[model samples]
Target: MGTRKFQGIYQLHYEEAMGKIQTGDLLFCSGSYLVSELIKKASNSFMSHVAFLFEWYDRVLVFESVESMGVRIVPLLHYMTNYKNTGKKYNGGLFIARHEKLIDSYFDQTLLKNMIRTGIDSLNRNYDQTEIIRILTRIKLGVGKHKEDNYEYICSEFVDYCFQQIGVRFPRTMEGFIYPEHIAADSNVYPMFEIVS
Candidate 1:
């Protein structure tokens, strides 16, 4: 019989490092590219105090030092469109850590506002959520374009939607949120974040 080799064991062992997050967290979410660009452009911006970048099994999330506000950073996978429930697949992306601590800084009003605005804006823009979702599904089947052209406008509207939700001033130049659903992983788009308390 020929010699068969099984999988080798290595001494190096790594554990999954998940940031402790809880409900009632105050998160300052923005686009991944926008934050990175701002950091590149403004060396002394508020993001200068980034402790570490957090990578989840799905998406890439960043962390920043928010001075007295505790830890804050932008959430990944937050695209400008309402693609989360479209029955499409989005691969992994970036994320921000210290979710629980961030939520402690502000009331739940902000998160609620952001979600509401996003949903409403899509409706107001004459975007049939069901139809758009169906189109996204068709695109995945290679039947049509990914609708990349509409992405820019959708993203722009998303920013406005978010602002309307929080009713607070955030960086205008910010971009999109990185979510796992956008990656075309599979039919089910996984949520990259849990509420941080």
Candidate 2:
């Protein structure tokens, strides 16, 4: 994507952005840390992580797998504020992306509720350390095999799996090698808005 196009995308405050997110929307984050830096380098994209949105009982939650937290649901506002407070130096910060086709074809109150339940079903699963190591090793050595294991998940894999549950598949050449850049670059998804702070 061009810098000018990215710059022209709508920007919103965290709170306002949270209010606008709908279930199944993708949340791509540019984290401020060493690991995030490594991920950006490996993927060659601005976003290092991705999550699926799930709004429940007036609170919006993000479903993602992190090295520290594994598969879990976190309050969306809390996630954004944590980054906003700490990631002053990062560019593109955090942004929301929506699959235009999915929104038009699959999004509805009932479908969203079901999607949230799908995410809830996978809570507490461990983060896929083997996959992370494999990805890093591949990026380092420039050769390795990519494997997909659902017993645990990395962030993008979790998002990919959730969408698959609803019959929407994000593109992947290899089964388990979904990266943040893959989702960001998907033809089906488009940037809606970004959070500046």
Candidate 3:
């Protein structure tokens, strides 16, 4: 087969992505370690795919690619849930992609910036739950001007979901269920499922 277009490999830039996690950065993250481990181990376990959602300080990033860690990118959002395993029959908080639907709700820079601001305001107002929910809602609903889903979905989709309204596609790699945007810099990481659950 020709090289895979979107493979399971860590592909988001650390600093740049973190920058997005500003005041309006609204998204629920389990924890940094869990998100980080998912990507590091996915590359090792065959199956050919990796997806993750990550957060840094405050911002959250979402990213997905089929060409492994360093290759082509197939970005998606707004209805996309968490990543699933390679061949698992069942999973949760994971949504498959429908290019058209995603393109309809992409996030732009200004919108992201504003969202960050919103998040900050929520935090300042002591609205932890609301802030997080707002962040995820914007991501899932697609707010902002540019309307591109660069790498923000990862963090945004960490909250509650009504997958029933949206169809989900199971992850196709060992490293599944992670948000696409977030990642741990360390080399030694594994998916939450791999941690002897």
Best TM-score goes to which candidate? 2
Supply the TM-score for candidate 2. 0.85
Q: lDDT per model, in order?
A: 0.29, 0.75, 0.28
Per-residue accuracy of model 3 over 1-197 as CA lDDT, tens digit each: 11122233233333333433322112222222443344324333212223333344453443332212321122122213323333322231221121222233453445444433433332212112333344344445654222222232323222111111123232221223323332221121222211100
Cα error, candidate 3, residue 166 (Å):
2.4
Per-residue lDDT over 78-146 for candidate 1, one digit per residue giving the tens place of the 0 to 100 score: 222222344432221222222222335555655654544454344334322332343344434534322
Give the winner by TM-score: 1 or 3: 1
> Which regions in candidate 1 have their CA more than 4 angstroms from the true location?
1-92, 97-102, 105-118, 124-152, 173-197
Candidate 1 local distance difference test against the native: 0.29
Clashes of each: 30, 0, 49
- In the range 1-197, model 2's lDDT, one tens digit per residue, is 31122335788987787678877788888776788988887777777889988677988877888888688887776664563356333444777888775567535657566667778888899898888888877777866666755569888888887777666777754534778888888877888888766
How high is the lDDT of residue 192 in model 1?
A: 34
Quantify how close model 2 is to the true structure by its C-alpha RMSD in Å. Answer: 3.2
Listed in order, each prediction's TM-score against the native is 0.26, 0.85, 0.21
- lDDT score for residue 35 of model 3: 32
Write the candidate numbers in order of decreasing TM-score: 2, 1, 3
